[model samples]
Structure formats: C-alpha cells, structure tokens
Target: MNIPNTYGHLPLAAEAAGAGHPVLTWAAVGVIVTAVGVCLVVLHRRRDTRSKRLTPGYDAATGALVVLDRLSAMTAIAGVTTELGELAGFISLLRVAEARSPEIPFGVIVATLDDYAASVFTANYATRLAADPSLLDSYLALARVQGVKLESARTAITTVQRRIEKLTGK
Candidate 1:
C-alpha cells in the first residue's frame, strides 16, 4: 500500500575527514616506539660496558699505590735513622692505606704493610736506644728486616695492578 509522506525530504550534508590512513598512523607510532626502545637499550649497554672498563676499587688501588710509593721514598731518604715523628707519620699513612685497601684484591699486600708498620713501630720506639753504641747494630738489623717487608709489599701491589689492568683492558 502507498501512503502519502508526512515529512518532506530534507537534504543532510556529510563531510569526510581524517588525519591519515589508520595503518600508516599506527605504523608510524610503532616505528617511533621501537626507535625509542632501541636507543634506551643502547644507552644501558654503553653504561654497563663503561663501568666494566672502569673496574671497581680502581681508584682506591691507585691511591694506595701512590701512598705506598711516597712512604717508600721517605724511607729511602731517611734510612734507619728516620726521626721518631717522621716514622710515626709514615706508619700512620700506611695504616690508612691498609684500611682503605679492598679485602679481595689487596688483602695480602695489606697484611704485608701491616707487618711493615709493626717493624717500623718497633724501630720508632727503639730509636731512643740508638744512642747506645751496643744497640746500634741491632737497630741496623731491624732496618734490614723492614726493607724486606717493604719489598714484598711493593711486589704484591705490582701484581694486583697488573691484574686490574688486565681485567679493565687498560
């Protein structure tokens, strides 16, 4: 059955609009996300590689070596006749370096340094008796003992430095 239309035909306009194709937009977003992720990964790996090259306790090791070298020089200049105050100063420096040394890498050297300090401690105290001609010979013998200890510590430090260099590829 045909019925008369109650409403007149009205023209409605529709406009088409879009930023771009959906696939291209999504693809661009994915590419940007992937690039950002890759950059972050590269940055992280670089930091790790740099840290590996640096090596842990490297500064401490070098610092201890410097202190020991200084002490060795002072001992060489002063010999067995080192003044009490100067000997005390060297002992203090040694103890400080030994305290800061890493337990794993420098333990043996630290022990050797401790022994060196012990001998120096005795020598420092025994210097008072050096005025006695009879005790002078004994003091010289003690000094010889300290020289041996010092050499051992130096050897140990050199070994550790070589190991650290090998590890860090430096």
Candidate 2:
C-alpha cells in the first residue's frame, strides 16, 4: 500500500525555504510574553492579598510584642521589666492567634484592643524580624503558635455562634 505525503514534506520544504523560521520565532515570543503576563498578574494578586491580610492594626499588636521580646533580652531597661515582658508575651500570643485564624471578624476584634497596642506590637514584630537574618526558624515558630491559637479561636467562635443561634431560635 502506498501512502500519500500530504503534509509529510512540509518540514523539508520549511527547512529548504527557511521561510517558517520567522514564524516559529514570533510564535515562541508570543508564548513567552503570554506566560510572563500571566505570572505578573498572579504575583500582583498574591501581593495584594497579603497586604490586605497584614493590616496596620494587626501589625501594631504584633510589633509591640516583638519589642517586648527584644527589651527582655537586653538588660538595664526601665522598671517593671518583667511585667512589661509578660504583657508583651500576652500580645504575642494574641498576634499568633490572628495570623493563624481564617475568621476575619474574630481577628479584627482581637486587633482592636486599642489602636496603640496594635501599632506598637506590629512595628516591634516587623523590626525584630527585619533585624534577624535567619527568618525560617522564626516563621516556623510563629506558624506553629498561630495554628494552635487559630484552632482554639475557631472553636470558641463556633461555640458562641451556636449559643446565639439557640437563644435566637432561628
């Protein structure tokens, strides 16, 4: 049986003519451009989401805790260092809760424990992280702490919501 070479010789003709080379180059460029555009759009959206999640109120509370950590590490601070240290520790726990929780409303309630506290915590936390060159360890620690807090907060919120539903009878 003899098979007809309809498009089989196209490659040979392309090679001989060299006319298809420019077309191939343009196609490649088009593909690359499209890929890059998609990547940029994805990256931009991720950045926007992160920024929104890490709001100023949230940052402040976390920052104060970080500062307290640093101050505790250093000696010759003002009076009531231990008390301040404890307060900072508490704030840190709260920040951890905020970071891990997906429920935004609860996080916002925790965040608004006075704007000053939130700002201080966030600034200190950011500064401490910035100063430390090794971030992986800190990030992992924060993630773990946040996860526990998140679960606890979620459970508490669910319980409260259930109670409200029971009372309202809806």
Could you say which candidate leads in lDDT?
A: 1
Kindly provide the TM-score of model 1 when superposed on the true structure, using C-alpha atoms: 0.49
TM-score of each: 0.49, 0.32
Candidate 2 C-alpha lDDT tens digits along 92-155: 5555646664554435434433232322223255456678858758656654554444444334
Which RMSD values do the candidates have, in order? 13.6, 18.2
Q: Give me the runs in candidate 1 sitting further than 4 Å from their true place.
A: 1-56, 76-104, 121-127
Model 2 TM-score is 0.32
lDDT of 1 at 148: 87
lDDT string for model 1 (1-170, tens) is: 99988797754432144454678878999999999999999987875675454444455455555656666654433345344335345445444544554433556665776677676634354556755668777767877877788788778767876776665457
lDDT of 2: 0.49
